[model samples]
Target: MSGRAADRWAETRAPSLAEIEALADAAFAALPEEFRTLCAGVRIHVDDFPDEETLTEMGCESEFDLLGLFRGVGLAQSGEVVSGQMPNAVWLYRRPLLDYWAEHDETLGHLVTHVLVHEIGHHFGLSDDDMAGIEAAADDITPSEA
Candidate 1:
């Protein structure tokens, strides 16, 4: 509703990686302060699709099988950062997420936020209560497609 008229969709294109990253940033920023604090130094990365290595690692037969992923030690495990160690990261697969958005009624922002929270929650070893809070925060931030 914010962009051009509906008749102009054919001239438009899918969201670029930069646009997706922006959406992720907005979604992340909308999270609760406490949750955001826990994710300090965590980087969010976006790619059109998961690489072959990632697909195999995730045991996915198709590229679209995974929407997002969290890679790194959970907060409940290790606290100290070792030299040259990779920082905690969340990967959002753009193409798959787009495909999913097309099939469902959820807004792109909401889906992205959902995937983000799931990954971050996994990183922090969040409890059910924490996850519920995350979901609520996401809902508050994302506008409904409906």
Candidate 2:
């Protein structure tokens, strides 16, 4: 490798939980306003990997098997907010995401955005096709529109 390439590689480190959370925020900000409005109260969390219980519940053979997850009631499953209810939440698995990113041809930011949107899709209880359409539409949003 070239001297500069090697130097750059040496300085690179995996993103921390806070950095991953920041990436998620930027990604959410980049989505269309309408969608953002719909995602008003969802919480996002970043962790190195899914917890042992989550892995077991999801039937994941390895921590790397899952990149992210969503928890809480979807719009389709909601009637009205109850006083004692927990808020909706999305969990981003950093180690798994980084592992996946290493094996794929995409920017980390782009991958984060993709995962965040998919989690939000779960919050809305959208079908795969419906989520795909929303993602396509999100891509179509221009700077001015955003």
Candidate 3:
């Protein structure tokens, strides 16, 4: 490899959990205002990989099989908020997302935004087509734009 290329590679490190969380937060902020308004109590979390229990529940043979997930009641199921409701949560699997990002031409920020929007779409009780549209909208938002 070229000398400068090697030097740059040496300085590169995987994003830490905090960095990934920051990316998610930025991505969320970049969503259209109306969409953000609807996601009142949704939470976003980042982990290196899925836990064993999550793997078992999802029937995943490998941790890399999943990149992100949404866990909670969608808007369609809600009649009214109860006192004991668990806040809706979206999980981003960092390692798997990194793996996927490496294999594709998409930027890391765009991938993160796509995954975040997808999970939020689920929370909004949107269909696959609806989520795809949302992801398309989010993809247009680059890191600089965000």
Candidate 4:
């Protein structure tokens, strides 16, 4: 195995929900200021697996079908805030994310960032092409650049 691969195997354990949440937070913070500014008031939640209702609602064959989900009115569709509107939120599935990481060649932080950007893209009413550009822009930002 490569040095990096060996390093990962040194202490094999799934990242806890809190750890995933931290990764999401770091990923969001690393995004460009313009992108982050548009995501104001969004909340993030991390769970092991999506609930049964969400599974059926999303028409998924398995819990692993979804890595993340966005629930709320898109920015473009928002008119006026009601008296008691549920805040827009993003839900990240920890087990599904970990499973995808094990099967892919990317780092966990990168994956979390990708999902975060994608969900936020939906909020901004952006097309897939636009989101791809944003992801590319994000990929260009190294830790030093961030």
Candidate 5:
């Protein structure tokens, strides 16, 4: 294929980072207020792929191995904020999410929300069952029909 055609093909196949971030934001907004309050101080970020340091820390052999990651103290363990301490953050890796989306029938927004909730759920010290229930409840209220 010609270079121009190849570039166009790549652009058409991949979701932009801005698109992913918007989806994540919408998904997060759909969550229950109780859950959102729990995630008040959390920051969500999106990247095309996981960095090398992240892969090593997560014990993954490849960047695509991790779709999302939660870093920082859980609500149950975090005491009063100490000086210079970093706040909690949840990272959503776009490349892995796109890979998963390509293989599954689910919408990208839903997938992003799911990963975001799962990670933030950890911050709240919620169990897997609790997170699942929260996800279901959130899905029921999602306005976009995605």
Candidate 6:
């Protein structure tokens, strides 16, 4: 047998929201082109945590309760925009995401995609079943097997 000893290493840097955002962007880009086209105008944001006000408004007892949020008019309500309307926005809570990461074995990109798709499901006024099917289909394409 060889005399070589095993080696160990550690991550020298801590992960930040920006890092997660970059990963999320790549994951989103890797999504089926048709899906990307449909979400072309939507904005995705990453923050360490939601503000106290947002938590209250969202009826969450703790910040970690919310992993992601969709804060804009759905497709059904988009036509109501008269003028000076803001574009759709989606917020991904990084702290919560990290908390989830600690408990799950999946990669960050996959988690972000799951949250993104779920939020987009809301944007399209899709029912729970509809969203489930959409997520299942996305999984078929991407295969969370990673």
lDDT by residue for model 5 over 14-55, one digit each (tens)? 668888888888889889998888687888999998889989
Residue pairs in candidate 6 whose N, alpha carbon or C atoms collide under 3 angstroms: none
> Candidate 3: deviation at residue 79, Å?
6.0
TM-score (C-alpha, index-matched) for candidate 3: 0.88
> Candidate 4's residue-wise lDDT over 1-146, tens digit each?
99988887797777899999998987888788898888888899999999999999999999999999998888878734567888889999999999999999888888998998898888888888988877777777735211
Candidate 4 vs. truth: CA RMSD?
2.7
Cα-based RMSD of candidate 6: 3.9
Give the number of the best model, judged by lDDT: 1
Worst 10 residues of 2 by lDDT: 137-146
TM-score for candidate 1, residues paired by index: 0.88
TM-score of each: 0.88, 0.87, 0.88, 0.88, 0.86, 0.79
Off by over 4 Å in 4: 2-8, 144-146
lDDT of 3 by residue, 2-32 (tens): 9998998799898888998999998888787
lDDT of 6 by residue, 94-134 (tens): 88998998799987667887888788777778788876665
Task: Give the lDDT of residue 122 in candidate 2.
Answer: 89
Each model's lDDT comes to: 0.88, 0.85, 0.85, 0.87, 0.85, 0.76
Candidate 3 Cα deviation (angstroms), residue 106: 1.2
